[model samples]
Target: MLRRSWHHVTRAASGIRWYVHELMGDTAYAKYVARHETLHPGVEPLTERAFWRQRTDEAERAPVARCC
Candidate 1:
């Protein structure tokens, strides 16, 4: 079942926390988590405010990249 976004941010991180703990024990998943973690250096709780702020910041920065 698909959970609401709020539920995801509030509750899902706990699931991820434990999953990451298990993943950390494995070399491949640990590296994947590390790379994924790097994209957000200080994300916590993943609140709506922070999510929108990051999205807005990315949107503002995107045009300057001039990618095809």
Candidate 2:
């Protein structure tokens, strides 16, 4: 039916959006929040700004090889 096909298309588009968000690190905070909730149920996860700052600081502390 047309409704079923439309549903499938919308689901596929949602999945693609999630994948792109993951690839671009836009969902990092969301993932971090989930992980924090799971691992430390009573603790609060860092805000997005704080999370990015921490990530950047850690990366700077331990640089990785990358093509220039």
- Cα RMSD to the true fold for all candidates: 14.1, 2.7
**Candidate 1 Cα outliers beyond 4 Å, as residue runs:** 1-45, 64-68
Per-candidate TM-score against the hidden true structure: 0.28, 0.64
Please name the candidate that would achieve the greatest lDDT relative to the true structure: 2
Write model 1 residue lDDT over 1-68, tens digit each, in one string.
35677787878789888799777643444454466579866654444556557767977878575568
Give the poorly placed runs of model 2, Cα more than 4 Å off: 1-15, 66-68
lDDT of 2 by residue, 3-52 (tens): 99999999999999989998989978888999999999999789889999
lDDT of each: 0.65, 0.93
